[model samples]
Target: MSTVFASPSENGQTSGATGGASTSAASTPRRSAVAAVTNRLASPQTINFVDVPAQEYYSTNVFTKSVMKDRLPKSVYKSLVRTIDSGEKLDPEIADIVASAIKDWAMEKGATHYAHIFYPLTGATAEKHDSFLSPTADGSTLSEFSGKQLCQGEPDGSSFPSGGIRVTSQARGYTIWDVTSPAYILENPNGTTLCIPTAFVSWTGEALDKKTPVLRSMQALNKHAQRVLKVFGHTDGAFVASTAGPEQEYFLIDRNFYYARPDLLNAGRTLFGAKPPKGQEFDDHYFGAIPERVLAFMCEAERELFKLGIPVKTRHNEVAPGQFEVAPVFESANVAADHQQQMMLTLRKIAEKYGMACLLHEKPFAGVNGSGKHVNWSLGSSSQGNLLDPGDTPHDNAKFLVFCAAIIRAVYKHQDLMRAVVASAGNDHRLGANEAPPAIISIFLGDQLTDIFEQIKGGGANSSLPSGTLEVGVDVLPPLPKDAGDRNRTSPFAFTGNRFEFRAVGSNQSISGPLVAMNTIIAESVDFCAGRLEDALANDPDSLNSAVQSLLSEIVGECSAIIFNGDGYSEEWHREAAERGLLNLKTTADALPHLASPENTQMFAKYGVLSARELHSRLETYQEQYCMTVDVEANLAVNIARTMIFPAAIRYQNELASTCANLKVVGFEFDTETLDTVTALVKSLQDGIATLEYAIADDSAVAPEDACRHRCDAVLPSMLSLRETVDKLELIIADDIWPLPTYQEMLFIK
Candidate 1:
């Protein structure tokens, strides 16, 4: 009930938050936390999906290709299809027709405003909304959307985090509409906005946003993939595209508990809490029956997503209490990235209406499984089908092996780059823990594929790995397919039957960063394969099979160090991985500098995914974000501990001393055990708080590396040590007087 001190990490981030200056919560009308959590229908959201079949509502909000066909002129529709299907440039003359069709479709969906949405460097979505109204000479308005307005919009580059790309007095960043990602109406209770996904860039044409690099990388990948397909005798192929299906995991707690804890409100995590008496220890929470309240939220969330054309297919309980996951089916990389950002936004907003807060931080709590976004990715073309799949025919299988070999080569050569892409302050808390993958980047080929690759290294793969079925003894349960082997959850990157799952991405991050890196690296590797095979065909046309085998063997022989089929969580694997020369970057600070390394920058520049200047700008911006996050966490720890925990502990200490004195006067023996324990923890808490304050103040400069090193070495240890003391106090202190919500109440009450 007392005024909580500053939560300076995005302080005042949530509504009615207490800041550096104290403010009272006692006056606010808050029901008992226990009663508030149990009220299942406290914030009822009326959505009935039972009657509305998915077929009727799915993609109804989007300006689908079907709608385009119905409205667009035949020539215009055909031109648009060529651009969408083949990655060809949109014909400028057809822009007016396309714009008019999209406007009509969106207007029919009840959209009055349109937004050019772009993903900027701040790791968040950006949008500038404009009314569809144009003033008439008679002072009335008419709905209008011009080809120029639909194609490009100007947003101030200097206002955003462009690193050094934009200086003062420069306000020129262009958001060019990306035709590949179709426009959709984003639904809001008040109104709907027509959202056009676009690529953001500086005036000089540098890639200034996340979407731009991803688009460029996709183009690079398609060009290189085409070169390889040409060598395989597919003269005319549809443009190949890497696809992504990001499985988002998150935790949801009641709104009362979420707002009560300043740490949770501003930082997206509980900075302080004792380990609960019960946790995910029993493993009962994993795949457990969904809580009724949570099930309703999921149902509504998925229904909203379906309307927007996001194909969410699975929803289930995850490994920790209150943790859950939702996975969408795969889509082209750019669309997937855009949908992923939308999905995060939708999940958080919908949770609020259901009276819960969706926690997307990688590690929202301690001593439990954290969250990760497992990105299932693959590359293929409509003409060639999925190149990663081991097809039924021998020739198809051989082509698959070549593409698979390219991925292996890419991962092995650029392990550091892979690690660097997923690096973030929130993720550093989860990686290398038992719940998530280790920092060392490696490939899991499964048993069957591993055997084939081993045989390729020996000489050639003479046969295919046969698939089998699992025979359950019970007659009621049907046989299950024995997949290429059981999946290795600990592997950072694992190749499933048809795609590789990048499990290192944090739950809160956009999938764009990882997809860009994956597409670019694989693009370079495919180019390498095509050059070698092209030379072989030039020399001897009849020896095509021999050339393919030779290329696979060469890749396997050299890049075998990256292929690990064992338990990736084992201590033995860490030592073995080190011996194998894989780079194990344990922290975001350690990994981010690699983004600006000459090799990485050169690769980005070579593929036209990003210029050197663009790459450097990204590196600078991300490093700044990393350092800022650490500094914020450190400061919050010091402020919360000194102001909240220390005072509460002292009050209890006073009460204990008074009780012992009063009992002595009443002629009774007072057991000093409780008193002594509280006294010692309070003193230790004070000492720890002091240590953290000193650490934070000492290294307050802006140098990215030193600042980060100080955080990792000094501030983080002090914060952890302080948390240990505070957590002990939490166990001993009276519940009525404790300042923050307990983990048990936050994690289990609902």
Candidate 2:
């Protein structure tokens, strides 16, 4: 029998990896870290991977429809499918039968326990396992599974951030099964456990987790989308769902290097490092040949993901040296969001087996390209196809334009909310950098769509401009392929061929928050479109085409200011965007507060997505998150400077002075330039450390908003200034004396 162990409890952990406390930096770590890394490179961790075809393990661990059909009574199976299809409440009568099938399948797979997995406000998975074995009649223990247990679970909520919805004394929180997301078994060598996706709520029935709002937003979108289909003479009953293909980017560094860097251990980023001699300047890392070890890790990760039914599609080296990206085929927004979390967890776990650490922080290293989750978002039904897809049929094309306008309007009006959802202290470092989209939010409608909208703005689009080909000078090369428009990599939100790629979502963020905003805002826009057309249809009782044209023209014209096909990174665009009244919120402090804006509160309430109180709570929760994140990073900076960098520099100076004194005694000459430079750097490092320490203690703001501003204005800049001094010292200090791992060692050694 395989070893069996239950899943761990939530215990009310904080968000992501940011925290106030961590292991102290070693007083003399360089020699040990370097020796460890050298030995590791000589005899690296071996991946004894046995390759298997994807089909062999695809969804093998999931209690999917096939399993349901085989084990459930035909009547029960069909009934459950119907409810799940319509997003309706599951029938109480069928719960027992469904739970039995799920339990049987899990038991057959050698699972002795099951966990109710839910995404809490902390932006991470929370689960506590329960054994199947239970006390039964006649004083015997029997393995049992029941409908009640499968449906609901109570976990302590007092420890999690509820944004004031649930006080510390109110400890009761409920996790209810989310039927839309399927159940799968998590395989560990020690044991297997049945994992059910669930939505968490407080005892007072407020959303205490990310999944609930996403589900609610889907319903809101569906209701308005059905009206659009009803007017156009299609199946109004068919459910419309937002789909997402979130491309995750991260860095993989040797575990030896990871263990040596206290800042990386605690802050999820290097607080100090000099730029390596050879960086990604050659543009060679992007699409470069994958290292053999990294390839093995990717293959195993994909294999594990395949078993869980995540259709991972792409893998390649990203623009940064140590950074890489993985993307999956599009799936329902809720499932994709769930799978994204699973993907991150799996990557981290697998990296360990290979003696590495996967860094998901948006900017783990300062001078290199940071990671971002580019979410390709669109709306569709299996029956009607993608509403955003511009089909060949003129009628289909017209509907596509209407839907396109809906997106434009949604983004134009709610750009602040879009920025707010992706706000974090970690992400703040990435945005507005050359590698990422700027802090200002704008839409990139490609040439074809932009042309169409331009025509619409002029009254009507008589015809869509064809995607012309580009001709290469070489006769052997094929002619340029048909494409409506060129890609804009720098835009925060850009409409690709069939979907809008939201490029501003930080690598570490949960896609749920962004998906919720996208769904809700688009739903409101669709409703606005439907309402306007409904008015025209009722009054005229004819000429549907004219009404659509008029509606398209108005939406396109009103929302035209948000459509920027130019470069987002340009200074000219920033000035122009400001002239057009677009917000350029450069920091989390400038962005997150918009969540509680009266208009946003009203919108969330109107769509039944979030109550005013719920929205306020989220604002408070994220505000606290932002504050906590900076506090941790700032503290780490101070500790590393005082404990690690300062000591190393002093030791190097003393060693140098001793050597120079001996050289002079022996009638030899030494360059005083080197000594002078080291001495100056040591003095500067101490001064920088003092400035950072004062910034850390200077906070007097009681309001969350003011606290965030203080961090943004005072703490962050102080940290950066100190980093500048520390990084310069890293260049001058002897490598043998430097306390932490260098970028070259971490980025290229693997």
lDDT per residue, candidate 2, 1-750, as tens digits?
111111111122111212112224543454555444444422333333345567878999888888888999999988878766777677888888888889989999999999999998899988989999888788989888899889999988777899988887888999999988999999999999999999999999999999999999999999999988877888648788899999999999876678778888888999888999999899999999988778778887898999999999999999999999999999999999999999999999988766678999999998999999999999998688888888643233778888888999999999999999999999999999999999999999887788777877887777776767887789998897677678999999999888999999999999999999999999999999999888999998686789999998898778889989999999999999999999999999999999889999999999999999999999999999999999999999988899888988998899899999999999999888888999998898888889988998999999999999999999999999999999988998887678788898889986
RMSD of each: 4.8, 5.2
RMSD of 1: 4.8
lDDT of 1 by residue, 247-355 (tens): 9999998776787777888788878999999999899989999987788778878988999999999999999999999999999999999999999999998887666
Assess candidate 1 and give its lDDT: 0.86
For each candidate, what is the lDDT? 0.86, 0.87
**How many pairs collide in each candidate, listed in order?**
0, 0
Clashing pairs in 1: none
Per-residue error (Å), model 1, residue 198: 0.7
